[model samples]
Target: MADRFHEGLRSQVAFVTHTRDYRSAEVLPSLARHGFTTTERPHDRETERLLAQFDPDLVVLAIDPRHDDDIALVRQVARACKAQIIVVAPGPHPHGLALALEAGADVCVRDTDGGEMFNAQLGAILRRKTSPIEQEAEDDGPSTITVRDLVLDFDRCQAVRNGESIPLTPTEFKILAYLAKNAGKVVSPVEILRAVQDYTYSEREAQEIVKVYIRRIRRKVELDPAEPSYIVNVRGFGYMLERRSNRRDAVRASEAA
Candidate 1:
C-alpha cells in the first residue's frame, strides 16, 4: 500500500464530512490498515477548530451537495491549516471541485473514489511536494532563473518578487518552469497537460484544468493580475509568457550603474 510505501505520512489524518459514518467507516479503517491515527469531523462551523486540534499531516474535507459555503470556508481552512488539503467533491459537482482547486487546496477527488484511491494519490502528491526540496539539497547545477524582478531559485525552491518571497504550490512551480522554458510562444493547454500532468486532456478539460492553475500563477507573478504584463492569454489559442528580462538589458544596466 502507498501509505506503507511512504512511511512518513502514516502518522495522522483527519476527515471532515457530512456523511461521516458512511465515509469514515470505510476511510478510517483503510487509514488504520496503513497505521494512521484518524479523526472524524462534521462539515459544520466547528471544522476548523477540530482540524486545528488534530493538527494532522493531511486533511481530507468533503463538500456535500446539501450545504455550500461561498469559498470562504475553504479559503479559511487552506490558510489556517499547515497540512496539505484534499477536497472531496460530491459525485455530481465538478464546479465545486474547480472552486476548491481555485481556493488553493492541494487536490480534489470525486466522492465515488474509495479511501484507498485517495491514499495512493496522496502519496504520489506528497512525493512530488518533497521533490523540489530534495533537489534543493544537491543543486550543484544552475540554481536561479531570473526574469526581471521575479527570480526563481531551484537551489532554495522559492520564488522572489523584488526580494519578497512569492509562495507557490508544487504544481504552480512546475507550470511556471514549463512556460518560462518555452517563453515567447503560445503554449496550448494540451502541451501543459501532457508536460505537467503527464497525460493528454481534451481541449475543454485541458483549458478548464490549466486555467485555474494559470489564475493562481498570474496572481503570484504578474504585477497586476487584472492586467498582466508577463503572461498573455491568446483569446482562442493558449498562453505566451513574454520574456521579462533580456541578457543585453542586464549588461547595459550593469554598465550604466
Candidate 2:
C-alpha cells in the first residue's frame, strides 16, 4: 500500500527494534513516503543516546513481548525521552499492548499497520498528552474512598485491598476509581474510555481495549482472577463492581462460632 503523507507522521521517527529484518522493508518505505526522517536502532540499551542524536518527534519500538526484558526496554524508552512514543510489534498480544501502555508508551500499533493507522494513533496520543488525564483532575476530591476492604487513595495514588497494595497504571487507576465511584452500577466501556482517555472509541475497539485494562485490574484486586469479584463483567453491556454485603461477615462470624 502507498503511504499517505500525514503531517503527524511527517515528524522525525526513531525506529527501534530487536529484529532488524522484521517487516523493515514495509515499515521503512511507508515511513519515508510519509516524510518521516528515520533513524533505526537495534537495541534500546542506549535509548538516551539515540534520542539525543536523532532528536525525533516519534519513537517506535518493535519488540517481542514474549520476552520479559523486552517489555522493560519499552519502559526504558518511554522514560528516557519526551518524544511521542509508539510500541509497534509484528503481532497482537493484548497483554503486551497493555504492558507497553502501562509502562507509558503513548500508543501501541501493529508493525504492519501502515502509515495511515500509525498517523491516527499518533494523533490521538498527541491530543491525550496535552490534557490532564481525567482521574488526575478529579483527584482534587476527597482523595480517598473506602468500600469494605478496598480502598483507593487518590492523594497517595494507591489502591489497597485486604491490606495489600494493588499496583495500577495511571489509566487502570482511573478506570478503577470511575467504577468504584459508581459501585454496583453498570458502566459502558465507551463511558470509561472517554473518561479515562479523553478520546472516544468506536464500540468495537472500546470493548476490547477496556477488557484488557479490566482484566489487569482484576488480577491485582481479585484474589482469584478466574472468578472476579471486584469488577463484574456485565454481559453485552459494560461492567459492575458489587459491593460485598455484610452478609458475608455474618456468615464468617457464624462459622467461627
- Look at candidate 1 and tell me the lDDT of residue 54: 79
Per-residue accuracy of model 1 over 1-257 as CA lDDT, tens digit each? 34434565555575554433346554566556555677765667777777777777666676642345735566778787777676666554555666777887766666676776666655555555444435656544567777667777765667788889988876677778777667777788889757754445568766776788888989888777876666667666777666754323322222100
TM-score of each: 0.73, 0.55
Candidate 2 residue runs with Cα over 4 Å from true position: 1-40, 44-86, 89-140, 246-257
TM-score of 2: 0.55
The C-alpha RMSD in Å for every predicted model, in order, reads 6.8, 8.7
User: Each prediction's Cα lDDT score?
Assistant: 0.65, 0.66
lDDT tens readout by residue for model 2, 106-135: 556776566566666554544433222444
- Displacement of residue 81 (Cα, Å) in model 1 is 1.3
